[model samples]
Structures are given as structure tokens and as C-alpha cells.
Target: MAESNCTQVTEFTLTGFTDNPVTQVTLFLMFLLIYLVTVLGNLGMILLIKVSPQLHSPMYYFLGNLAFVDLCSSTVITPKMLVDFISKKGIAYAGCMAQVFIYDLFGMTEGFLLATMAYDRYMAVCHPLLYPLVMSPKCCFQLVTGSYLIGLTNGIGQTIGMSTLSFCSSSVIDLFFCDISPLISLSTSDTTLSHVILRTSACLFGVSSSLVILVSYVAIISAILSISSAEGKRKAFSTCTSHLITLSLFYGTVFFVYLKPSSDSSREDKWAAVLYTVVTPMLNPLIYSLRNKEVKEALRRLTKIK
Candidate 1:
């Protein structure tokens, strides 16, 4: 029987947050409402960016792409989570693999895309004279395309690596979705290589992209300081406040959940998952719209037109 289970984990149960009847129903309703807002906010941001002529720039272009990624990521993770909450919660092996691939596809893409946007901002603020030529529409497309391709490659590698492993023991996943870390922890097979590969790849994708964003902000700050007028400096810095806040919120939760020293606590990690997987996507559009004058003005114009 052990050998048979090793050959294939036909189905894996998800030990979602709670099993209490009332608590489960309450959690289900809450998550459903949050998922709806996430969808609407991300989709609305994309639609507004598309229709507003004033937003036809590299910044807005990248924002639309970010919104698309957020929307897809939330959709990929949340609906299935909701289903698991309300019904028998078991996913086939293939289904779990698909979840990991799709979730990482967007998650990694967003990491690199945020770095790309930081670079965009750096060029715009620090190298204004050369920004037009350096960050041309073609370059924007290539950057976004390259980020997606990298994410695709990462997702494929993660899926293939996961498929190679065999699960001979307990097949219960103690998380909301098919997070790679928790899934690997449940594996009975020797996972030394899998752990190394996942850790290396996560660092390569997460830390490297974060480094790029950090360097870009350094340059942006230097440029902002060089400005002669106080208002000019404030204007330059204000544009980045929203992105900075988003970056902090994202990296903070992810680092805590995936990279921190105490990350082995799966019970605590589920609530952290709620943060990045649930809360962040819903807050993104609101953050950008409320913090950005351009987005707010465009939204006003759009409302008046309607």
C-alpha cells in the first residue's frame, strides 16, 4: 500500500484553516466577498487604464499588466479555495500541480514586473532627457514579455520538479491553496534536491528582482535630491509613494511567510497566506487610485463621461 501510494498520490486532502461548521461558513462568506472585490478592483483598474487617453504611457501600461497578473493570481487561488471551504476538499495530483504552476506563474511575473516598473520610474525621474528614447513603447513591451517568459520558465521547472517527487505518507495539505513550500513539506520522499532547487529559484526570482527595485529607488532618490525646488522634489517622490507602499506590503508578507527564520510554522503561515493571496490584490487598485493624482483624475473624467 505504501509503495502503491508512492507511485501516485491519487488525491490529496486540504486541511484548510478551520473545520468548525459556523466558523467555516463565516470564513467562506468573508473570503467570497473579498474575492469579489479583488476581481472588481483589478479588472476595473485595467478597464480604466485602457479607456483613458491620459493614461496611455509606460506607467499605466505596466499598471494594466500588474492588474491583469493580480486578477489572474487571485482568480487562480481564491475560487478553488472557496470551493474547498464549502465542499469536500480534496485535489487530485494533477490539479495540485496545475495550481502551483499557475499561481507561481503570476506571482513570479509580478515580482519581476514590479522591478521593471521601478526601472521605468528611475528612467523617468532620474534620466528625463533620455527617458523617451530609453523606455520606448517597444522596450516596455519587451520588458513585460520577458518577465512573463521568465515566469513561464520558472513555473514549468517548479511543476516538473514537483512531479518527480513521490508522496508515500500523509497527503493532507495544511494550507488554503497549493503553496509549494507546504506541499513539499507533506512529501514523504527525499526532498533534499527539491528543497535546494525551490530555495535557489525563489531567491533568484525574489531577491534579484528586489535588488533591482532597490537600486532603482536609490537612483530616484539621488535625482530627487538634486532638484532645486522643494515642490519639484516632492513631486518626484510622490509618484513613487504608492509603488513603495505596495512593494513593502507584498515583500513584507512574502518574506515573512517564505523566507523568515520562523517560516516552518505552517499554522501561522496560513494567516500570512491570507494577507498576500487575499488582502493584497484587493488593496492594490485602491492604493493606486487613491494615492495617485493621475489615476484619480482619470477616474473622475471617466465617471463624468459615463
Candidate 2:
């Protein structure tokens, strides 16, 4: 029996959405715009929340953290992807690993953050009078800290698993960045253990966070229906609706990419990946900020101050 000659990949080539130069250029421009918007929007959100005392609450605190995560997450993957679109070689092995670490960190962090946001909304809308008591500063700190801890643990586990895997042969990654799926696919050695670890990690972090969000929303909807006044119900629903939209966009695309069977994954599926990684991050600020009067008013006040 011959030993598999798998060593660390020297360099990895990225096959972004297309090989056509024209299409690549067009896609590059589009993603550039999305990336720019994601950066500015998220930055603006963080600044707005920081400067506006009125926006300082458990809800905005979570929202600010979400914006920060989205910004960093988008930056981790998109900039490299954009450069890869035009560059001769996409990324080196070290660069790829760095991407993997950062991408996983922020992605997992956002998952936990989303769940935290859901819980925050649940407390605020369902138990308005007790919102302060339930989501006290201490409790809010615990929730945010917990979110970071969960994400950090999962990210470290996944990164360690990926680091152990040997990649000797074809170092070409089909997708835009060094995603776990593509990395696993590219490995020359037996990947059963790695796959097991990956699946377990996914279940531990991805599935559990999603389940928590789902339960929170269910309780939230129930609470909303119990309200007697229609206007009151509308007002309550509006607060969390943007969060729901952002959550759906994020989890939907992630589940599609990671959870789906290989048989179902196609070129089109890669496009779907773009929706969450690129499009959704940019849309989050718009969804949360534009729709919320508080954010708008804060922006207005900031503008007037300027």
C-alpha cells in the first residue's frame, strides 16, 4: 500500500462565479458595490448606536454587535474574493487558512448573536414591563459574552480540525474562499474523521443556535397575537421583523450550502452562497436601520449635529 503524499497546499486557486472575463468583471463590480455598502452601512450602524444615547438599550446593544459581526464577516471573505476575480492566482495557503479562521469566527459569532438578539426581542416585546428586569445590564452582558464564547469555541474547534487535514494535491478551491466544504472536498486523505468532526461542530453550533432562534420567534409570535390592540400588535411586530428577515436570509443560505447533500449542490448553489455571504450582510443594515424609526431618528439627529 502506498502512502498518500498529502502536504499543505502551496497555493489555492479560486473559481469564483464564472470563468468568462466579462461576467467576472461584472460580478466583481457588483460584489464591490455590495462590499462597500456592507462596510459603510455596518460602520454607520455602530457609530450611530454609540453616539445616540436614545439607541442605547439591550436591543441596540445586540444589534450593534450584529452589525459589527456582519461587517467583519463580509470583509473576511469578500475583499479576497474580489481581488481573486481579477488576479492571476486567487490566494496562498496561509491566506486561505486565515480566511477560514476569520470566516468561521464571524459566521459562528453572528449565529450566536442572532440568537441573542432573538432573546432580547422576546424579552422586550413579550414582557415589556419586565424587559428591564429580565434583560438587565448584567444579563445583557452575560448574553453577549455567551454569544462570543460559543462562537470562539466552535471556531477554534473547526479551525483545528481543518488544520489537521493534509492537502497535498490540487490546491484549487472551486468556490470564492477557503470554505470548509471545499477544503474537505480538496483533501487527498481519508476525510471520515474530519467530516465527523465538521458535522458535529455544525450540529453543536449551527443547529443549536438556529433552534434557539426558532423557539424564540415562536414564543414571540404567540406573544404578539395575545395583544388585544391591533395597533399595538403592529408596533410590536415591526421591531423584530427586520431581525427575522436578516435571520431568514442568513440561515436559509447557510443551510442550503452546508446542510444540503452533495448531489443537490450545483453551480447555482454557489450563487446562493453569495446571497448570504455578500448580499445579506449588506442588506442587514438597511433592513434594521431603515425600517426602525429609532435608528432613522438617530441618524437624523447625527446628521443635524454634523
Candidate 3:
């Protein structure tokens, strides 16, 4: 009966990137450009990988999936955020939850997929003789399946956690979109369990995935150094450097945002979100393709396709 005292809030007012009209306009335009480029770039990458037989390896398979994740993740957050900037009102509770769920799905998938990619790279570079046996199509498929399994588990768990919390009071979320932290803050119900769940989820999905990638790369770097031929070493290093760069940027921002305690004035949180959600997606195709002559050639051939 005491729990019935809770009031139900239908909508949430978003305190967007900035309250300043000028800043909002500027951010809107900038993010619009970022979103457009992210879509074009990731779509193009996926298409290129799909069409090119040379890109049919486990590495490219994961890269294509990564592109897919980036595209979906950006779609979840950026467009609505853009609308929020232009429109007077913001997102509703249901809409926010839907976005949050999808965002969690894609983001969590990306983390797991990246770790899987690292393992793929580890086999390819560290044990080239066994690469064929290790990275068979079935194995690759299993890896990708495992990633989605993790993503689904995380998404459903978080979504349900969010759903159980009653947002009966102020629904104004002080962010561009509804995130777990802000949503938890808005809930009228006690969020102790929710917070613990979220923190545990973060560690399981985010930190654990990053650790797997880190360890895989550590082994990879060692293997690269052991190559006696300078040319062999150069080629091996080049193949992985771009991936490592993207990995660093993605995980760095993610760890900074999720692993740390929340502070309202934390510019790092906003910037980290931008980095992982907007900037990373836009940059992935370029980073992966520019370093990959095969991908560049594939794009060239794709453009020339009649």
C-alpha cells in the first residue's frame, strides 16, 4: 500500500548537450554531420566486406559486425538527440527505455565482439600455422554467436532492471538521451539494487571484455616481436595497429564513463559518450580501411562496380 504512493511519470525532459541556444545549435549541426558520416561510413564498410571475397576472413567478418554495431548504436542515440535539440520537448518514458535497450544491445555487443576480434587476431598473428584450424568458419560463427548471447543477456537484464524501477517523480533526465545512470536517478523507487545490478553488469560486460582484449593483444604483441624478418614484422604490425588504435579509443572512453563514479560536471562522461557512440563509429571505417590496402582496393572496386 505504501508503494502505491508512487506517481507515474509519462515523459522526460532532456537537458541536452547544452542549455545555451547557440551551443545547442552548434552541437546539433556538428552531431548531424557526425551522424551522417557515421551512417555512410559504416554502411559502406559493411557493403565492401560483404561484396569482397578477399575480405571474407574471420577478421573482416568481425569488422563487418563491428560496423553493424556502430551503425545501430548511433541510430539509437544520435537521431533522437538531434530531434531533442530542435524540438521544444524531449523523449517519453517508453521511447527512452526503447532507446536505452537498443543502445545497451549494440554497445554491449560491440564490447564482446571486439574481444572476439582480438582472439581472432591473436590466432591469426600468434599462431599463423594454426590460424586456419583455429579460425574456421564454424568457430567464427560461434564466436559471433557468443557475442550476441552476451549482448542479449546484458540488454534484457538492464532493460528489466530499468523497467522495475518506478519513475514516479521528476522525469527530467539531464543528458542528451536516457542512460542507465540518469534513469536510475529519476526513479521514485529505491535504486540500491538497481545500482548494484548496473555496477555488476558494467564489470561483467565492459571490464571483462576489455580485459580479454588486453590480454589477447599482449600475446599478439609478443608474437609480432618474435618474427625474425623485418618485413614480416612490419607487415604483421601494420595489420593490427589500426585495430589496436580503435580498440584503445573505444575502451578508453567506455572505461572512463562506465567504470568511474558519476559526477554531473564530468565533461569526460559526455565526451566519452561522444567518442564511443559518435566519433568512433565515424572513424572505424576510415581507420580500418586506410590501414588495409585490401579494404581500400575493395572500396575502389565497389565504386567501379557497374
lDDT against the true structure, each candidate? 0.88, 0.85, 0.85
Q: Per-residue lDDT of 71-129 in model 1, one digit per residue for the tens?
A: 99999888998998889998988889999999888999999988998999999898889
TM-score of each: 0.95, 0.95, 0.94
The prediction achieving the highest lDDT against the true structure is: 1
lDDT of 2: 0.85
Q: Is candidate 1 or candidate 3 better by lDDT?
A: 1
Candidate 3 Cα errors over 4 Å, as ranges? none
Clashing pairs in 3: none
lDDT by residue (tens digit), candidate 3, 14-56: 8777778899899899999999999999998998898899899
The lowest-lDDT stretch of 10 consecutive residues in candidate 3 is: 259-268
Candidate 1 contains a number of clashing pairs equal to: 0
Per-residue CA lDDT of candidate 2, range 230-268, in tens? Answer: 998999899888988988899888878877887776898
- For model 2 the TM-score comes to 0.95
Model 2 regions lying over 4 Å from their true place:
none
Clash tally, candidates in order: 0, 0, 0
Candidate with the larger TM-score of 1 and 3: 1
